[model samples]
Target chain A: MDMYTCDSMPSSRSEGSARSKLLSLAGMSKSYSPTVCALNGLDLSIEPGEFITVVGPSGCGKSTLFNIVAGLEEPDAGSEIRFLNKPVNKASELLGQVSFMPQRDLLLPWRTVIDNAILAIELEGKRRADARRIALDMLPEFGLAGFENQYPNQLSGGMRQRVALMRTFLFGRDLMLLDEPFGALDALTRTMMQRWLLDVWQKHRRTIMFITHDVEEALFLGDRVLVMTARPGRIKLELPVTLDRPREPDIVTSPEFIRLKRELLIAIEEESRKSFAPTPSAGH
Target chain B: MNVARDLLKHLCEALLRGALTVLTMAVVWELVVRVGGVPSYYLPSLVDVLAAVTVAPGAYVDSALRTIAETVLGFAGGAVFGVLIGVAFFQWKALRDYLFPMFVISQTIPVIAFGAVVVLWFGNTLWAKAVIAFYMTFFPVTVNTLQGLNAVDPRQVALLRSFGANAWQLLTRLRLPAALPQIFVALKLGATLSLLGAIAGEWFGDSVGVGVLLLHAMYNEQIPALWAAIFLAGAIGTLLYAVMSYIETRFVFWRDEL
Candidate 1:
């Protein structure tokens, strides 16, 4: 965890640096019906051009944390959420600057692949011709050049997700909130997608907050991996990965990679056991 | 067989099957009429019916036009009104809750029941038939369009929100296209109902149109003319349905999956 933070945190910085701090959430908590506390006093910050992966056990409020940040849900008693230092109330305030991709690909099946990619731009006031041009340009860049005119149903699950990612990027958001974008892919496909995503992210470095349950994926993709505890999830630890530039799958086999992965697993397991353990001194 | 031959064989088989089925139906009808031994004054033969169609074709054509006009006018009115209502309801949740029950309740009031009241109000004009046709057609259009608007994927809505798309943008790009399939469904239902509305209006009040001609034939015991009028009405209805289906195929090619 100490090594993780040091790699991501800049050494010396004056006020007004080129790297803009995009979002900050402090003391954020949320709860709902049937008495479940989803998030508990979560504090986090996203720096521009930084990739942050959040990993935790199931029901750790990872999704809840994302919803609050994306303005999909209200934090119970939290302070204002700052997007570029301005308080966000609804989706409209953060429009055009942050594009969100949910667990599902969410591509409209009736439309062709090209149309699906161009959907975001078309909604942003570009005419059909310009939108198509922009969509076509994103295809080859994302390794989907020839499949532009195909329908979503015609493509495999992985290809459909690629189309979805292209659509999200075409929207031109400075920030992207991706919730398990590759969670639905098969093992072989997921690894391939991770590598492909890394290549894409390098060319166009947008600040990203990816939600996942996989520890290796977190270490592989994110500049910093944030581990959250079980129910009423709070930040348990933060790990910054300083492996190397342009990450490869072979990095997972290294001693440092294994050590970091083991540490994250231990942290998550401890949180899970603590939540499940029967209350002490209950015998009366 | 190769692909082309297979397709050709399927087409020939379908055509042959359809013709055979229609021939059987006609033969069964003729046999039933003969066995019943009803007088010619009450039920005419197929030959008598064919002769009636050719004897006074002008009057039959005029009545056909009037009925067709009523169906077209009512269908257009219902479609326009249904879409407007659908858009308004989708845009405002509060309005949707308030107006949805009212729209459902409107369908419960039968067309025949409404026709009597409409005639009392419009006094046997073309408007009376149009009102009946509109009543029959409007509900399907409204209900189906509402369903379509609601059917847009929630994930897509979230994606739009993230992209900074405003309310208008969501409606035009997502909701409108989603609602199109439902609109076509409404059109199919409305087309058939519109014909019924026109005929019902003529039954209750109109001095012209196919319904009026059928009434004259029935009163005079001219069984051949009555059958001829019925045939023409069926032909007109089939034409209306065909035209609407063709339009649906052309515009909503994407709906082939659904």
Candidate 2:
């Protein structure tokens, strides 16, 4: 983990030691009630602009982790989080600092394309006219220029997701947490979205933590992939991609890509068994 | 230009349909009384009813306007109060748990039973009738508003919360807007209810409104006059309901409903 950080961070800020990254969390734990422990002792860190992928089994608390980071869910005490080198005591302190896209598009049905694109900025109490101007400038890149007047229902699933992405992007370009962004898309659309996402990510070099169930997607997109444990979720493995950036589509068939995919699949399969097995585990 | 043209076209179509409906009703009513040899005392002919209205057109018009004004006043007050209460209920679970059941209990005590008491308290004033309408109009709006607010997608709320939206912001921007289709549904129902309330209140001794006219016709054994009062009352309720539906259509244009 120590070596992985140095290797990926080419633009590492050297204001001396302590390795001040974009975000870092240690000893994170969350439990809904006395019986339901969702996450336990999860430690993770993100570099300035590295795209990281997270994969886990069905009940493994990926969403919980994202919620904690997004400031929607407060983790149990004993967790420590630091963002932009400042210690965040409350989960809400991280809000507006990290951009998040949930499993669904969640576009407001009533809002037009341009209006939807600026939802986050509007929420932040910015002047709507200025947000509109900013969103208009960025609309074409998201392939939503002509659909400015159109509502969310009028757009295709892919376009709606892009619009949501634009909303997230327009809010802040520092850190983005995407949970299965293309999970609902068909195979072809998902593949297309991945490529499009890569193109957009390149254009705007924002650090992203993308969660996906697809091993291939995790391999195709990440600078590193983190496989989480089942139930009381924690980082089980963090494998660096070691693949070249601006990666070609044909590289999925490459030996290196296949090798990485196998490694991630093995880690995920082990955890999936524990969650699915009809047996009494130590914790209920 | 196109939107206005479309609105005009919609209005003309609606009017045509309404006219066709009234014509069919009138024809059926006239045929039943005349062709079936129904006595005039039992069921007045449509022509007799129309002639009754023509004879005291000024009185009927004045009475109808008074009832409508009362209904409108009550409806607006009830709708506004209902929404505010709904929001309050949503904000505080404890308050909702305590007061909501009382509201439900209050509803069970028939509005008509205590309607006389309302008249006793406020006495024969428009305010009394409007208060009754307000009572009738509020409960459904409150229930529907609370339901609508609760029905907002939790994920959407989470998304907004992630954007640093405070509770008030969440209510105003996400919950309220998302709850609108449901709220409008209640408003349409409330429109009819308020009218019913206004008329019912007038029954507890008032001399100006259609309710007073209805009582007069019933006692005098003037069957045509009674039919005329019924038609005017029906017209008032239909007018109020039409206004609500129009506002709902214009505002909640995105909702996929007829």
Candidate 3:
């Protein structure tokens, strides 16, 4: 465990310590009633501006981990989490600091693209005009510049997700927690979205905790990939990717990329096989 | 669907419906008066009713306006109160647990059975009619609004939580907006019941409004007048329903695609 003075931490993170001590989960466990243990004693940390992807088999508490960090679920036992150096006692305290993009793009069906983008800022008490201006500036980056007047249903799945991402980005938060954001996209669209996301992330440079089951996705986008075991999830391993930035989609065929993908596949396959075993372990 | 074609087809169908309904009602009235051998004093021809409506237009119109005023007031007040109650229940589980069943039980008592009680408590004024209408309209609004609030997506809640939205923000931004469709359902139901409530109150006690006029006409065996009053009541109800539908379309238009 590392403890740094709040003043020494990056000032960009308004919570406690800066220096990318960004988000850490230590000895954290969550149980939904008695029968289900969603996460068990999971320990992990993300640095500032780091793109960390959590890859796990389905039902491995990847989304659960996001929920715990977002304050949607209370952990059964753990040391309190600090954003900067300040204790994160409740879900609301982390609101403006982290923008969460859910698996399903939950754009308000009634609101236009621009309005949906402005929602978080409006919730934060920014003037409608200002929030809208900020949201407008984000449209071209997401390739949704002309669709401002359009409704969510009018957009394709990939476009909708881009709008969703734009909404999160326009909220102007430093940390973004994405829960299988591109999981619903088709393969080609998913690739396009991954490229777009990397471009957006490069420019915004906010710390991100992305949850996905795709090992390749984790390797492609994350600075470090955290592989979680099946149910009663725990951080099985964290592999750092020293791959250079501005990488193209074709980089997935690179030697280093192939090696990392095979390693992630083996680790995930081991977990998948364990998930089906007769007496899988409950707590790590 | 082609937008203009759909609209034109819908309008033509509606007009056809109007003609068919008028023809059916005329046949039923004529049959009751002729075949059932009911005297002209009790049940008159549709023509007679139209004549009565034309002769005493001011009287019927005045009563209708009064009844409509009561219905509108009651619906608005009930909707406001119901929304507040829904929001309160959404926030406090303990309160919801204790109050929700009570609210349900209140609905179980037929409004007619409570009519006299309402008059006794509130007296025979327009305020009393409005109170009765409000009671009739409020429960649907509360129940539907609560369901709307409860139906908020867990993921959306989580997303807002990540943004560090406070309880108020979560409720206003996520829960309330999610509740709009449900709230609209309640509003539509409330609009219909508001008319019932106003008339029910007047039936128990009150010398003004359509309900009272209907009673007087029934007493004098003025069948045409009675039928005219009935027509006005139906028209008013339809008008209120149409207005509600328009408002619903205006606000929750997103649901039209679904």
Best candidate per lDDT, number? 2
Order the candidates by lDDT, highest first — what do you get?
2, 3, 1
Q: Write the per-residue lDDT of candidate 3 for residues A229-259, one digit (tens) a residue.
A: 7777777877998688888878889999999
Tell me which of candidates 1 and 3 scores higher on TM-score: 3
**For this target, which candidate reaches the highest DockQ against the unseen true structure?**
2
lDDT of each: 0.80, 0.88, 0.81
Candidate 3 structure lDDT: 0.81
The residue-by-residue lDDT of candidate 3 on B17-86, one tens digit each, is 8879888978997898888988777678778988998897888878998999999999999999999998
Per-candidate TM equals 0.85, 0.92, 0.86
What lDDT is obtained when candidate 1 is compared to the true structure? 0.80
Better of 2 and 3 by DockQ: 2
RMSD of each: 6.3, 5.2, 6.3
DockQ of each: 0.50, 0.65, 0.54
Each candidate's interface RMSD, rounded to one decimal?
2.2, 1.7, 2.0
| TM-score of model 1 (CA atoms) | 0.85
Model 3: C-alpha RMSD to truth?
Answer: 6.3
Q: After superposition, which runs of candidate 2 have C-alpha atoms over 4 Å from their true positions?
A: A1-18, A280-284, B1-11
